[model samples]
Target: MNAKKEPSIWQGFKAFLMRGNVVDLAVAVVIGAAFTNIVNSVVKGLINPLVGAIGTQNLDHYSSCLSSSCKGDQGIHLMWGSVLGATLSFVITAAVVYFLMVLPMAKYLARVEARRKAREGTHEIIEVTELEVLKEIRDALIAQRGSVHDER
Candidate 1:
């Protein structure tokens, strides 16, 4: 009797690490972190300064006190400016990722799929021709066998 051996833990771990999804996720995380820095810089350097020209230099400073005093967390302070800044960062990041990465990747994948299908179509035609040749060979062999039997 033959028994199949199960893979070792190390082998399984290596396979998991080598998977395309794991590599893709790692790349995505790195790119996301880098993209975050760019978005933060845009908000802090460009957007904040433009907003500052109208009111304050930092959007985080723009808050409203719900109570009489908002000093040192004494009262309810609605920090709308920080929320605005975060929202802006998120919107910009999403837009950039969609337009630059997601859109291009989608188009590229479509092209690759089209090429694959085209190759498969050509392979199918070749297979059909091979089948026809095989059928003709089989028929010729049967005919020759019959002629030999008739001569006997």
Candidate 2:
């Protein structure tokens, strides 16, 4: 029993590992991590400067102090502005991708897929009731019987 159970457990593990989604997700995670560096560089190099020029100009770079000394333990300073800048850049990038790239691609692909499906002449399934199935079978049997009787 234990031997049988171990093989089944191993089979389950193999099946899980072989799933397309699991592999796809692992690749996506790795690629996304690599892509993050590119995103950050674009934010820092180009977007940050442009935004700065238009607005407060590198306001996020500095933090204020309640007192002069930022010595060892006590200071009332916050880098909330940099956090705000990073947040804004992220939001803007997301918006641009959603509006400019993802939205249009999704609509275009959907229409193309619809057209392809139409050309292929595949249709949606309509569920038939049990009565409908019985009626169809009855009609077929009657037609067969009529043919057989006519021959005799």
The candidate scoring highest on lDDT is: 1
lDDT of each: 0.94, 0.76
For residues 77-146, write the lDDT of model 2, one tens digit per residue: 7776698777866786677668977899999999999899886664332234556788999999999999
Error of 1 at 102 (Å): 0.9
Give model 2 RMSD, 1 decimal: 6.3
Among all windows of 10 consecutive residues in model 1, the one with the lowest summed lDDT is: 65-74
